[model samples]
Target chain A: MSLLEVKDLKVRVDEREILHGLSLSVNPGEVHAIMGPNGSGKSTLSHVIAGKPGYEVTGGQILFRGEDLLEMDPNERAAKGVFLAFQYPVEIPGVTTWNFLHAALNAQRKARGEDEISSPAFLKKVREVAKSLNIPQDMLKRGVNVGFSGGEKKRNEILQMALFEPAVCILDEMDSGLDIDALRIAADGVNALRSPDRAMVVITHYQRLLNYIVPDVVHVMSKGRVVKSGGKELALELEESGYAQFEDAA
Target chain B: MNVVVAKTGTGRALGDAFAVARDRLPGKGAISDLRRQAFEAYERMGLPHRRIEDWKYTDLRALMREVLPLAPQPDATALDRAAGTAKAQAIEGVRRLVLVDGVFAPDLSDLAGLQKGLTIRPLRDVLEAGDALSGQAFTADSSNPMIALNAALATDGVVIEVANGTVLTQPLQIVHIASAAAPGAIVTRSLLRLGRDAVATLVESYLAADGATAYQAHDALVVAIGDDARLDHVRLVEDATGAFNISSATVSLGAHAHFNTFGMTTGAHVSRYQLTVAFAGEGSKVETNGVNLINGKQHADTTLLLDHAVPHCDSREIFRAVVDDRAHSVFQGRIIVRPHAQKTDAKMMTRALLLSDEAEADNKPELEIFADDVTCGHGATTGALDENLLFYMRARGLPEKEAQALLIQAFVGEAIETIASDTLREVAIAAARRWLEARA
Candidate 1:
């Protein structure tokens, strides 16, 4: 069975349809890239799958591990091994990154009927992951993403992904505001988390991100529907030809 | 033309009570005169009503229909009950000064550990001896009727004096426990004078004996910090659901002194904490912060007034309130820079979070700057929790209530972090967590 199956998924925001009968499937150990132009609903697909509110699932179904994904809450979906690296990370003042990550990890453990991690163990894990991501130790003491530069914020998203270690990961426009060095670091962090039993959906408008973290399959999204899907070469094809053809076809 | 008259039944009751008990009250000489003058002033003003600008959000006259009689002296049984309750609420490693039913309980307090330069005495004894410090403590004139009422009918409290250049390592905890098994009032007043170059930490906590009946408590603290002195004051009021707790503090800061105060309120059906900090000398620094967590039908109000009477003084006030259920939280902060207080820097910010549709918060931050060279500003914000932030946390695997608790903690953490002592900060945070747990 597939890890995630979306059959004719339709989503609407503000009474306007954003995802019109979009269908996709991802198997375990597969990294699929969904590339599209601006306003092509790439981010909407990732958000809807992550169970974010404000997007109405007007039609179709989402199955995660053969269970109805739409029936669960956002936190439940997260505990069920689904994660989304937000395009624009939210800044939560007064909530230190250390405290937030600890709470999130323990919450997931509690939801899974597992014992909570000890303080020393949790701190060690955080330090190891943070070091690998090149996140300053002092940054963990500050509020979550507060006063972080564009690059730092992006790197922080990857840090969360590494810490959560979800079964299905979704990256939405992760390369939008990152410099080349930051982009390479972020991609390295993502690449380090790939596993045989985990699946990932990388959503971006530019193909530059694909050069660092190669994908098994690439899907072209236009006007809320998947216009084309091919091997990794298709990313380079679209990068050279531009999205003009898909835009006109849609 | 239609004419409307303000109701003064609550005010009249209090005045009548004071008049009947004047002869038996403690104090003599100047202290007696001060009490008389204060009572007369209270009679002239009466209980503040909605019409008064300062008391607009909190109309004591309407909320408290009438005043209860003064609390009777605590019997042995009451004292036993208070002692048991104090054990559960006690903080480790602090010298405890327990007050049962408004009177100092020597047996329950630990005065044996008194430092060499520290002097502690019951207010009743101090007043009876006609000590000059008692008169000086209550000399500050204020327009608030509640302060006047506290002075007029105060039964007992403690007077603490630290000698010049004394630095105490342990904090002094002045715990006030209401052990009345009836609907009555307990009035207490304390005077704290820190000598020049002295450093101390004072914790004033208000609580009720377990399984105690409904009661009303009126408490006051008068603090004077000498030049170059540093004082960390923390006020924790967690009364029973059937209790009404009203407290007031008047503080004066000397030149080069550092005064930091943080108050937290999580209990009581109705509570109002009023604080007035005056910078009497140049180059002094003051920070006043508070957090209120109220639920059910609880009503909590925190009103602060910062008076920058001298130049080159800096002051900041931060207050946060979390209102749940049908509760109402009120924060009124006023920063006043006198005409000659040039180069005075003052800022105040008040934020309130409403958890339910029926919950309400009223935040009013005002700046009264008479000095042209002063930089003073005030800001107030009132709204429900941000849905986006909540979702962001929830999406990371926190349950709905856990996410909410985290956000609320963060909302009030800014104010709690201002506490200078590490242990006190943790205690405040633990109290907040308990409130959040009960709310969940």
Candidate 2:
């Protein structure tokens, strides 16, 4: 059985339908990539899955480990081991990254009836993870994404995902605005977290990120529905063909 | 002889009970005359209430409808002992000087460890009862009724003098403890003088032990700081229930001198703290920051007046209030730059957070600039906590109540962060946190 199953998921933004009967399923240990052109509803699918407010879910049935996912709030979904790397992350002032991540991780832990991570243990873990990702300790001390560069913001999102170690991770155009070095680091961070019991859905418009973090299955989404599905070679083919064929279908 | 004093709201019956005992005006004939004139000014104005635009949010007229009686002459020794170490423990690392019921408690205070050139004594003891600095800077006889009343009843006030070129490390604490044997009114006064190139820290606290229908008043003055002098002043009030508090401070700054003040009010059924400053020398700066955390049906009002009299002066004001239950919070701030005070930079900001639907917050920020070359602006904002931020925090696993408490503390912490003294900053932060814990 798939770790996350989405059947006939429909999403609307501002009373306008964005995702119409989109369906996909990811079993544990599998990395699925959703490649699409602009306005193909890739980011919308991620936000709808995360339960962000103002996104109307007209019709959808999302199951995580055989449990209903739409019934849970965004944070509850997060606590249930679902993480979404936002396409455009928010800047929260006066809330340091260390503090924010500490709260987020402990909150998830407490939700699962687990003991809170102590400050010392948490700080050690953060330092280790941040060091590996080349993120400075001072950056963690600063307000979350308040003054971070585009690449830094995306990298921080990946760092949070690694820290939380979610069961199902969604990267919504996580490679956008990232330089070559940052993209490599972000891809490495995501790849390091992949396990037999975890699933991931990477949504992107380009095939560059796929070269670093190769996906087992690649699907073409047009008009909120997956129109085509193939193996890893399909991404390279699309890159060479440029998405003009999918644009006509959309 | 039954003297019938005219009653206000609570009536002369209570007024006779709270009338101040033992009026000790200084023998400086000229100074006494000026005091009388100031008192007359207050009489003419007569306790500004909601009718006055500046005092609109603070209804002193409604609060003073009934006058409480005053206690008879105090027992100097008992009052002196009560003002000492017991009071210093409330706030740590403080050099204490206690004023009991508006009278200086000499035996209970400390003058040791004071750096060279700094003098701490009673205001009456300076220059055979009059200091040159107090004569000039502290001599404002405004049309403000509250200032006039404080001047008329001024008796025992501290005289703090910072010698030229000396910077004291610890804060010099002046504690004003008002004790009423009966339900009556009491007034207290204090002064500070920072000499050229001198630096010091001053903390003034007003507290009232269990009392019945008490009224307390305070009038304070701070003189010019010479070029390169630094002074940090903090005023706090914790009064009893059914008590009325009116406190005022007027400060003047000299060339290149800096004055920073922080005020926190947690008590007093109806408390008003008035802060006014005038910049006299060039390149002088002043920043006034205050936080008022009120609960129950308490009423807290903070009013400020900044006067730019000279050129090249900068002034900033940041005040925040948290009102819960049926409590009401008021902030009225005004910045005035005179015609000759060109190149004056001033900003005034006031924000209030209401925790309940019934709680109300009134804020007024004003700026009157005469110089076209200066940059002056004022803003006032009153709103409840952002629902999105609250939801975000709650989604992080903090209980709903705990998340709200954290947000409230962060909002007020912005103002408290301006306090330059780290120890004092910690004290202020802890105090604000305690307020949040109890109320939020």
**Residue-wise C-alpha lDDT for candidate 2, range B344-406, written one tens digit per residue:** 989888889888899998888878888788999888888887765655454444555656776
The two-chain DockQ for each candidate, comma-separated, is: 0.80, 0.21
The residue pairs in collision within model 1 are none
Chain B TM-score, all predictions listed: 0.96, 0.89
* Candidate 1 segments whose C-alpha is farther than 4 A from its true place: B1-16, B140-142
**What DockQ class does candidate 2 belong to?**
incorrect
After superposing the true interface residues, what Cα RMSD does each candidate give?
0.8, 3.2
Model 1 chain A weakest 10-residue run by lDDT: A155-164
Expressed as tens digits, the lDDT of each residue in B187-274 for candidate 1 is: 8999999999999999999889977657888899999999999999999989999788878988999999999999999988888988
Native contacts, share recovered per candidate: 0.87, 0.15
| Error at A15, model 2, angstroms | 5.9
